[model samples]
Target chain A: MKCEQISELLPDYLQGSLSPDQRRTVETHLEQCADCSEEVAIWQKLSLLPVEQPGPASRARFEAVLQAYQAGRSNQPAHNSQWRKRFSSWNVFHWLRSPLGAAAWSAALLAIGIFAGLRLAGPKPPSPDLAAMQSELANMKQLVVLSMLQQQSASARLEGVTWSTRDQQLDPRVLSALLHTLRYDPSVDVRLAALDALSRHSAQPQVRSSVVSALQEQQSPLVQVALIDQLVEWHDRDARPHLEKLRQSPNLNPAVRQRADRAISKLN
Target chain B: MTLAPDEDLMLQVRDGAGEMLGVLFDRYQTPLFNFYSKLTGDRTLSEDLVQEVFLRILKYRQSYRPGTPFRAWIYQIARNARVDHFRKFPRQTALEPEMLPPVVPSDSAQEQQEVELLRRALRMLPEDKREILLLCRFQELKYEEIAALLGCELNTVRTRIHRALQELRKSFHQLTKGTAS
Candidate 1:
């Protein structure tokens, strides 16, 4: 067999898919050709190379992404139904149709309001189980928020940021996801919502530093102003340099620059 | 009967059975990781790319055509994920030893040296040739299947693989020569 023809068959030969006759021909050519023999040896060694095992972190990251996707899928319908159930229970039109019922309902609401005021005045503290339940619920809300923040829809991401404000207790993942949204979310509304959510967690040192770090990267004037306000409120002196940079940036929005200027002086 | 095919699992995922993707992920995660690892020689980046590929599959599941080969479709996504990653991080093309698996006590010195040389030589090959070679030799994909995945003729795939092997041979020779010197 000609070397040219043998070269064409080399791929199949290496794969062991070549016919016996073809393999014999290529082997015959290799016996006489030093270069072709070397080529075959190279491929033989190449095919024997070991596969690398991915680190455990790879699987963890994949599971995280898959779980986020699955959570987003499952909750999409649940979210719609929850709002439906909430509004469906209002029955305002039915209440208006019956004046007696409306009066009774109003009296009940007044009594509940007075009772709630008394409870507030007495400062009834939550039991341990209740506090634990609330904490678990907060963590669940954080997961949902993190999942929604990954959605393609800007409104969904905005809702995510809004959901993060449902409880005072914050998950570190929720804080990071909020900060990520603040830094990278494409929609101005989503970023603004994230900035607002982060402000709610401003007391946490990590959240404070995240907001301070995000301040240098934020472009929108409204978000920049909001972040500057949070940093100034926190009295985060570490933000002085970034705020100074924002104040001097040529493209700094006038409103944002003013906020940054005031924030810098406050920190100083 | 053989178990439910990957295509069926993916179709289920496309049809709102999102958890079915777990099956696909378990099946393809390692292959996809090895694919990226071979292409970039960066384990961490390869893992990220594997995750990105699965995410893309989920995101674009609606576009999957029934009766198409699931392996090819997934591999196509894998290739695109690697390209997109490189596009985003252009300066990360240089292969680092950090990507190589940690040496075990059982491995011989010569074996490790040969593996290192092979890796360096593979890295020296042009990107397309290296990818085709890896797909064929390492991933064990048939040339015809690759042709279908790449939207090219079978002969084109065969010729590309052949030439890629030749180029790799030249690279291996040069690398070994450099080592000897």
Candidate 2:
């Protein structure tokens, strides 16, 4: 059997998942090729690395979450401000208490509200300018609401704005909110929006720094490309080394490379 | 009136239950975090993703079914989050299969070195293959469970796992040859 074919079956053979004939073929190759034999030995040893369990930080985070729950329940008086607050307070407390309970309540409420809202709000569409105004007003209100929500229940507040539209341009306050969301928002959608917004205004140093920070720490190659694209636009000579590092990254998606190459070309 | 265990909690949080959700987070955070860490190769991003996954769970808590294994449901959420993350930031370079790090020469001093090398090499593998190996070897998930989690056919899972291991083996061979030279 060719080395490549035998090589393909090595994992299955090791796992005893291969057919008897295939296994024999691979075994024959292994005996003949010291290189393949050594490869097998290394895999066997590499597999022995201890599978790490969740560290203390994870448990601590969970404990803190439980504390937050207890605090929310014992401090129920905090929810008296508005109808939204009242609903959120109750929802937070219930969610803290039981998953099944929360599901049932959410399912019922969503069924009523989402269905009713879709039905009622569907037909009477407002003018685009009015809609934009309304959305902007809501976003402005959400800024305060999101801040309060963050203090009270950061996770929930973040969730509420995960899919929120970007209407604030690069206003400092709005930028701050987007930055906070990029760093702490629980929704990838929100994070992506923050990235997108920052990319749009990549000329600012603060925006550039945040995007670069996210890029350095980001694992998602897609997000990395977004940051790279922005950096490319900025034409920051300081960014060339970082771009080079990305060029050498084996996991970098090819599409990202084409863009990176173009960016590097621009830098040069 | 004191809230009934389920009813009181349900009524109190009609919008959804904060405390009950904590239990769910406690149960699955580690596996999910580890999975994301492996997938993203960045600790900070993984942590962020984990928190985001929980946030999503909270946002959609009302949609959850009572008897479903919370792990499976959360995994589905995590998978969706990952897909969305990828969609937003598509990669520029073609991801090459990573080579394995050279093995430690059976000495005690070399053990730690070997382990570090192995970890780095593991990190280098294509994301899909690395994920499969991790699910099978580290998480010890059954093939069927993995197939369900990955949304692929059972045979596809088997093939991918086999291919990943083969690639790792090849990488290791290359590393050894390079070192010996």
Candidate 3:
């Protein structure tokens, strides 16, 4: 057999997966083919490379991160530091007791009543530019979602994620912001919500790739598992490697690994 | 007593058992260190990257699900961590051939020389070829797993490996023949 034919079987042969006859044929070819024989020899000898140990401080660093992670989790609510700063001086009880606050509360109630009255009113008379008005409303809502996604408060950001899901077609700007939130949001809850919102738009290639990339960057096991399930639901054969890579991480939660494995199998 | 599997320990880590990560750190730091060290030929950077990989695990423990192999999942992180680091701070220095070292000094002088020549040859291949070889040969990733990791077909992976090996053989032969002359 020509080397081309033998090359087809060589990788499997090297892996020791070949049948006896095929293996013998390859072995015979090897006796006459110095280059092929030498290739196998080189492969066998690669094990000669030494495995090196990391410096001792490696464990200490890991310990620090683990401790910090737990400590941070314990103090998580407090760490929405930006929002906390804004809310700090505005004590709820103090504000409620103040005359100025009482006046402000009355004004808020009056505004709510007015808004409700407008909402309850029947649809406006047909206008010359109803499409323009609808587009303006959509732009306003998307602007709200984009701003809320950046809010210092996790719940508001989560609500922003929830609001995003209501739109059948996400504005590109809103979609990118949701993708950003999915990847970098400090709160796992908000990130998961963003993932849930974006998962609805898998028909968009951007959504699929962002979710796959998030599989690498995402820290929440719940979100990770959900991402894996979404990929499987889409039958995204492209996501198999990302899932496989996810399973390969040494620091993985076993549950997420199992989910990635199952997703890979299902996709396969 | 049987040691708990890495995956189970990871599950523990995910569920607020922060100390469980220490066990994993102990288990993986060396293999990961060697992977980066060999691939990049920079021991200091490799050590830093290994530390970074574990830190990411702690941060992303919620990302770990139970159904996959823990080793593969961590490798996924390890690969990304390295890629991201290089992306942010691209390497200015090309890898040094001598960096692929401590070739075990055995009794056969000729064998040691051959090993030395082989390391240089391995280093000489293009970055991707060297990486694929490292992932399969050194890291022990199965072909299917490599195919997934590389985002290529299984046959493409096989052909690439064969071509990589072919290149290594040619280089080693040339290096060896040069030494003989």
Best by DockQ: 3
Candidate 2 Cα outliers beyond 4 Å, as residue runs: A1-43, A52-56, A63-268, B1-27, B86-108
Candidate 3 regions exceeding 4 Å error are: A77-268, B96-108
Candidate 1 residue spans exceeding 4 A from truth:
A78-268, B96-108
Instruction: For residues B1-181, write the lDDT of model 2, one tens digit per residue.
Output: 9523433332333343466655556556777777877666566556646765765554455566555544556677887877865664455564333434345555646666566656666766887888888777656566777888998987788778767766776665565565456
**Candidate 2 lDDT, A1-268, residue by residue in tens:** 7776776676566667788888878888988998778767765876666544455565554444334333423433433212244346666575445554354455545555644564477586456745665555454544543343343443444443442334445456666667676665543334554676556666567876776666556544445555676676566667877777777878655545555676687677
Give the docking tier of candidate 3.
Answer: acceptable
DockQ for every prediction shown: 0.32, 0.15, 0.38
TM-score for chain B of each model, two decimals:
0.86, 0.74, 0.89
The residue-by-residue lDDT of candidate 3 on A217-262, one tens digit each, is 8776656766786787677998887888889998787556655776
Give the CA lDDT, 0 to 100, for residue A84 in model 3. Answer: 23
TM-score, one value per model: 0.56, 0.45, 0.62
In the range A1-268, model 1's lDDT, one tens digit per residue, is 6778877888788889988998888888999998789878888887567877888766666665566555434534544223223223243344334454455455555655654555576566456644654555455556566766776555556666887888677777887888788888876556756877777766777777778777778665545656776677667888898888778878666545655776677677
How far is A246's C-alpha from truth in model 3 (Å)? 34
What digit string (tens of lDDT, one per residue) describes model 3 on residues B1-181? 9999999999888767778888988888888888888788778789868866886686567678888788788889999988977774567778676555544444559777886787788889998898989888878888988887778999999999999999988888887776776
Ranking of all candidate structures by their lDDT, best first? 3, 1, 2
iRMSD (1 decimal) for each model: 5.4, 5.7, 6.2
Per-model CA lDDT versus the true structure = 0.72, 0.60, 0.77
